[model samples]
Target: MRPVSVRYDNSSVRVCMKKKAMCKIGLAVMLLLTPMMGWSAKRLNIVIIVGDDWGGPYASAYTGIYGRNLPSNVVKTPNVDRIAQNGVLFKNAYVNAPSCTPSRSSIFTGRYFFNTGGGAVLGGTWDFTIPSFPLLLLDAGYHIGLTSKGWSPGTPRNAPFGGTAHYYQYFGTSVSSFSKSVTKWTAKGMPFEKAKQTMLDQVRGNFEAFLADRKPDQPFFYWFGPTNTHRTWVKGSGKALWGIEPDSLKDQLPVYLPNNPEVREDMADYLGEIQALDAYIGVLLKKLEEIGELDNTIIVATGDNGPGGFPRGKWNLYDFGVATPLVVWYPHSTGGRVVTDFTTLMDLAPTFLEVAGVAIPPKTDGRSLLNILTSPLSGQVDPQRTFAITGEERHNAKARDDSLPYPARALRTARYLYIRNFAPDRWPMGCPYVAAHVPYVFHDIGEPSPTYDWIITNRSIPSAADYFTWAFAKRPAEELYDAHKDPGQINNVADDPMYADIKKSLAEKLLAELKKAGDPRVIGDGGTFDRPPYTDLKTVACQDTIPLNWAPGSHH
Candidate 1:
């Protein structure tokens, strides 16, 4: 509409006047919108659902294998699939470390695992001095609460980080009791199927209770850490609860695992646990919707690391060990898209802080994913997100008297994975002698699962020997894989002359990035990671004399 206009002294002055008028109008609109936007300008209720030891490929939505191939089996995750349909699914998400403590620490602090002092190792204490995103949210006036596992499998005793302060006091069923409760229910005349369902329901009930207790008018942050996908699943759970018979899954076994019926059954059980977790996620989503907070809340569902207690999966630098499924749903913005940008758990802390309008600390190693999250574009939203860095320090302290650390740093790109084993002489997994001798040992493969038993029992067989070697044998100093050509990462092309240039470039880049990040391994103080005052009583003993020409300052 051609309305009355004021004349200006010059065109530039008129433009400035127009901009000032628009700014004033924007400020007035923002002030009016403040109440609906919560206490702060970017206040958003955050719900992060973390599945313990779950991997990306297990998600039906990511692979489309669960529903299409195993329709009769009840390991279907229609609910989680729904989230992917309604939100942004990240295809190339990973954790900084494959272990529990380090992975969680990275997510909480927005720092690399190696940079986190004691947090770099399993059963080690997290340096509470590093700021946690949840604590920051709490200080920002958001009601924070966590259910099931939080930053755990590690002691948070005297640390200034005050573990309890991160979450508001909320009562819920303990995740530790999940096994006992299922056993008790089964013994009390309930069918194994019904008992398993009851156990999952209890977890969902805890989350519901947390939501119910949230104060009105206060934005909330809740960490829903579910133990459903963790190791030690009830034996025969797949058949008992989900009708997923072991024999029925012969054709669907993953390429990485042995195709025996036993391994298939284990896979089924694992899938059942993931399905149970997905069920709870569905319940949580429904609860949010019922309470009218779904639109305003940012729901992020991911796993801490890869699948646990499997060969070459968890506690290793393989893709299966570090790659995680990341699905983020913020209904008000950025939904129904698939992002292939490389993402690490380290990025989550800064992302959460950014969403809450809180300042991200300067020392953080992670870059915020706000741009990728809110962008309309799909694959590779950020050009800089081309690669992810992953490493491992000490996973299980109960391996031997030495509690040796398996230190390996890896750089993963869309095309290749480059790994540098700081101590190539040390076993990638634990020493086989210690593994065979130690009763109830928490070796690199993790808890005594069927896969561990199978590998150990069948080690004499040629095929089993090959599998064991691939999973546990000592690796070379430098190893590289063409990830695109070899998704299983079984073939090593590091020494292959054809790929020398790629290997050299990646190695140089990896070293530069590590140095820039202030990684202790690159610095001269890496030896401190191996020595003294371990949280576990088992001391770290060097089996061989430290080599005269060994990498200086290298530890566990």
Candidate 2:
């Protein structure tokens, strides 16, 4: 299929309204022409399948094939592949933030991370003032339910007076209880394949329960967050339990990581988790088809952020870190296409609202993708989607002086990526040493993993020191990468005089957008973000070296 050419101008609003008006007029004309048509507007069902820490390339549909010999193939996502084949696949989708909490917050609220205040930082409280699409859909009479993870890792501090309980009530029911009950069904004595199937069945069972309990005539919005790909996986289970060979995955390792047996083993395990998630998705799709709601439902499959536990991937602003896989299957609308326009996950919130015929809130920073989704053509349906911006604040504040966030923002265009680090002196990852009386330790990586341990142990070795630097070293204030020439983003071209013009242009564009969005960093109130009280007090440690007067306990 040829790539579709689209031109996006300032008249997007007018275009959208005109299209909507025409649709309404067409409906009215049809009714006037024939009363026997019996066409009634029906609410659409929404199902968002979000994977935790899953990268774009892991899905076979995105990478073009599913096999052990294929490069970058550690897992086969046939179910996810089906969604992309049957719907519109976004080739260039990025998260607002690389970390889970902040990224998910932006996705739910349709706002930028910095605009979310305390919610911008990891494990920080969510400001309830910002609207969530689910709540809006619920208010609009759509049955809403969430399984596994939701707006999580941090507490919703302002969720009415009842706190977390009230928050769950807003979603109708929390499926965590059901999830726990199903976990018991995975008996220890069961065979590996049977046990894995049982676990996947549990997830599907939760979704079935939600469907069974919903009002028959009312449409529904379901948020399905699977935790399969998260860290602390069953080590070597891919080989011992899942029958996946580590050798088969060696060639599939990410370019940023060393192509060794240990890394390949880790990748295989991760792929195992991804395959499990994909199987569960197949179950959900089958259920939707059986219930006769498949065609009426809007199914969206995506990831919160990039791969976790890998170097310069998760928790970093590199392309692999922030890029996500987005597949949208809106029945009776658009299908069998691919969109190359730059897209942010935040757009999903506005897209959902627009599709539901609900007004998008004024504070939303993301534009609706409804125009692109409904359009028959693919590729660049929205010409204005030429860039994607992502930022990062504090993430995993466990290392010494971790309260001092490594603040950074980045702008990604079709050919280049520009980043501006607010605090260049601090380590991009956590400080090498902890506050406690212990040897060199790094805690900012979020979870404990063999990949991280290998990097830390070999930091002093001449052969592996560069990898360590790439993973945890302090970065310069400005960084630029030629995306076309270096998709891996291994080279820093910011200091190259030849590319100064491009760098300056991207930097200015990013700053202008940030300022327009009322970002705290550009508006001169950025200090407030750094001063927000940490949700987990234990992660706080004194940062005496910071130039700012902010201290751990003193911020309060």
lDDT of 1 at 205: 72
What is candidate 2's lDDT per residue for 208-278, written digit by digit as tens?
Answer: 87887677666788878876677767677666655679899666665567667777787777777777778
Expressed as tens digits, the lDDT of each residue in 1-556 for candidate 1 is 1111111111212343457776455445434643544564436889998889988456767764223333123357777777777778888899999988899888888899988777788777767556677766655557777777778877773122246654432444534334445656777888866766666566667776666666666778888787767887876776666676788777665456777877877887787778778777887888888888888888888998888877877888888889888888866565678888998989998898788766576588999988887888788899999999999878877454467576789999999999999888777766543322344223566666777666656666787777767776779999999977777788899999999999999999999999999987888866656665443446544243223332212212
TM-score to native of every candidate shown: 0.84, 0.83
Q: Which window of 10 residues has the lowest lDDT sum in candidate 1?
A: 1-10
The 10-residue segment of model 2 with minimum total lDDT is 1-10
TM-score of 2: 0.83
> CA lDDT of each candidate?
0.73, 0.72
Output the number of the TM-score-best candidate.
Answer: 1
Q: What is the lDDT of residue 232 in candidate 2?
A: 62
